[model samples]
Target: MSANSKVVDINKNREELITFTEEEVETIKRTVASDANTDELKMFLHVAKSYGLDPFNKEIFFWKVKGKPTIMTSRDGYLKIADRHPQYDGLVSDVVRKNDSFKRKSDGIEHEYGTERGDIVGAYALVYRKDRSYPVYVFAPFEEYRADTKVWYKYPSAMILKVAESMALKRSFSVSGLVSREEMDVQQLEEDKESPTKRFKKQKEKEDYIDVKDNAQDDSLSQREKEIKRIVGKSPKLKNDLLNYLEHAKKENDIGEEEKMSINKLDDQQFTQLKSILQTFKRLA
Candidate 1:
């Protein structure tokens, strides 16, 4: 059978699988894989199709690093692939804490934690296979994989657990080459332009796209600065209020490094939402 036939045969049961038509291929190139060349696009499509991943649904997508395309998926995507494996029996995972009870033995793993689990130290995942006597256990430490992003800042324990689960799934299913976005750094995620939250927000539109702008500190105003200035046009009092309020929030630890880094490039809606949130914090102060 031809490569196309093989791809079709692999995912024949999945009625929602993407059909790579001439126009559809053009759309994929223009949207998600814009930076890719003909060969890169072909390779991306082949891998995505082979794994029954639909890029439109955000199961798998391309990441451009230094003008080169790299395939990346989410933790859920890893689970999807693992579930498809004939021997994949089940998965078990949890976050470990500094004060929590955790142990690893030759045959099994043990962990216990309470609601007040001090701080997330690490996470563990166990992938059960039908053919294996013991499940595959992988422990991922927080310090090793944590990124200084808003998501990690807000959900450290959950994020670390995802990293562990992704690692375990990859190893258990023999999945290779592609990396999960949860394992990537802030710079890599930023380079992707479209974040998971932004994708969801724009999912309804036919030509949906996130307006990603540079957050670099230049002498001139950045896009975010410009937007803020426009919002505060001719309102010197409001400008001072914002600056003073932000300074106070920083001093109170209401805002951290992650928020500061992201504040540089937030779209208008996000900026407005931040202002509303800061107003709430101001009341508590």
Candidate 2:
């Protein structure tokens, strides 16, 4: 992705490093204010620009996770580099529904896993370079996360193919030291981004807090979600009010296209706040 702003040109060759978003600019300034590593931040910015990546994308740079500043290319980063590379040829990548071709681990036997669609088992990719004699091949298998088919629910085929393609590209161009940090699982990266602070914790409290301390000991997230839905379903007026409340609570930029449950996604503190608003609407109804 192209940068949103221009960066300070630090080259004798007169090349601008890259531009940063307002948030990144803040991070850089904040790092300096807090006596943190600003030099390392600049170094990462340069590396990101060299790769033609936008640090503001959170793939290339984010201050929330680690202390040191360095470039971390996202999945987008890998795709972008592949798109711009002069030596690049077409990529051959696809989802593998079964182990039809490859040998199996259990019995050391190769049999048809069959035509019935099941969980996507693996991904295969080959990066062909015009200059290289041999194409780089990569076969990446999917791993289960917390017993949930996490990333599979989002971009199972596409993401898996990307992983394989990136793996092949990075390995093939080992001499160039090319890297895409997205080779790190995108699902894991998302979960890591939310750490130490839940992304939905930003809901504004428009009403007094409701006391849900009694059910606070319940460990089941499903239980809380069900209870909240039940309460909201009691009246149409309540439901409308709940939706409107959430809509009003978020600023224009704060809302994602499908971020309707910003309130529902909130933590206990905000949940209680939302419950109070629901109760008010119920009383009025």
Candidate 3:
């Protein structure tokens, strides 16, 4: 999102016509440059488009995970996508407790929410169509677990039902381009604003592979690192000249610490900036 741009929350049942504009996204590019990478921003856009959500209208959202953007939608967004398809008589949902399922009959309008009963897991949905013999079954589980707190950060009941609902909708109507909002980031949307410490606290809490020193034992790479590799993989011409570009960037930025540094070794911010710059070069090439 841009400094001037804002996202508005809407009802779960409401339908919206979203159109992403160049200006709005360009602003995102500028804003992300300071903290996030171009690929992260680009992935947000791609996921939004592929899933048919619009950030401009707040149908979906961008979350800052470890100072990088991750795509996610609010409970409202999850619900909105769920109700898009037509329902059949076979439509049924249930509340899950431990390993047992409590069958709940639906009136086709009212949904039965899950419970906090013994080891309350999540809700289940069975979406059916006119032609299909078997109803499309979907399991929507809670994704708000916080390892640090050893608890689920999001409301259990809120997530349980919506997870089931969204799952049913996506599996039943996936061709219409629906994406699951589960496991996506929603910290910013949940709050109007948070303190910087609180904002980055989530990042610190999450265990990510970061290589700051020239010699490190951890060879595992983060999602951002993988994204850089994918971006580089797109352009053979640019990939061949990556070393030269890296050298120029280091010289221009006044960095002479290490003559040799792999692209994966660059920190998140540096990698993001480099990817953006290389993308421009890729386009030209």
Candidate 4:
């Protein structure tokens, strides 16, 4: 198939593919010139080959790992090294407990956060285009490990290709510009203003008021009427009816026949629909 045909097929499967912008490419070139190391250069070659770009593309830039190297030979070696280094011992213990699937070394170096073990020490690099210039980050892990001897071998080019393909899949959809440090600080400040407990308490208070209102409208015979009124004021339906009934009952000096009948009818309805409401008031009393 033609190159265009292959590109079409790839695009069909991965719809988010984006080419680098010119400015991004130039920045990458500068970074590569200033800081590219052997490992980063290797990763770049791996990424380029997987993307069907020339492995020696002039525009590509690579970033190298920095800081003190932590080396591990075997599980015992890792532990030994960690025990000697206070800062790294905790990390080693955490990895041993959490990463049961991996073979660890005793004495070499502590693994940094975001590092994954393949067969050897895993490392990361960024790939940028010379033409357009967006960064595509790549992670390469050791391909083979000897548990007893504490040796790791470089992952093969084919394995590296797979890793590169995975990185491409991720980069294709990723946003280029990231939130600045200042923006992140502002976001954290806003979040700190409202804690989870405070938000929950506010929601619960609103719900309690609603419950009190609903109960008042449905219960007239409730002995805890005073308490309910205090909770959510008098219900509109019950307020007028209750006032009129009280007034009439007081004027008659004794229960009138019509009033007695109306009271009885209301009692019967309450026994059926508002039984639970009455029970709640009784409990409160």
Q: Per-residue alpha-carbon lDDT of model 3 for 1-285, expressed as tens digits?
A: 445655432223434344355676665555333334656665566656555576545565443433445454544565455455455444566656664534534423234434534665666777767767667776655443211110133345545665565566556755332333443222323552567697467433321222222222236655655665656663333443354445444544565453444565455666666676555433322
How many clashes (backbone N, Cα, C below 3 Å) per candidate?
0, 0, 0, 22
| Candidate 1 structure quality by residue, lDDT tens digits, 1-285 | 224432322235444334565656766776666546877887788777766678767677665544456787878888898887789999999888888888898767877777777877888999999999999999988877776554577678888888889889989988776777676553344454677787545432311122212233445666656655544444322333344434433433445443442345444544654454333222211
Candidate 4 matches the true fold with a TM-score of 0.15
Error of 2 at 81 (Å): 1.2
Off by over 4 Å in 4: 1-119, 123-125, 129-134, 143-157, 173-285
- Candidate achieving the largest lDDT: 1
Task: Name the better of 1 and 2 by lDDT.
Answer: 1
- Top candidate on TM-score is 1
Tell me the tens digit of each residue's lDDT in model 2 across 219-276: 5436655566667653433543455545544432265544344445565654565565
Error of 2 at 37 (Å): 2.5
For candidate 3, report its TM-score.
Answer: 0.42
Question: Between which residue pairs do clashes occur in model 3?
Answer: none
Q: Model 2, residue 241: displacement in angstroms?
A: 31
Q: Among all windows of ten consecutive residues in candidate 3, which has the lowest summed lDDT?
A: 145-154
- Clashes (candidate 4): 22
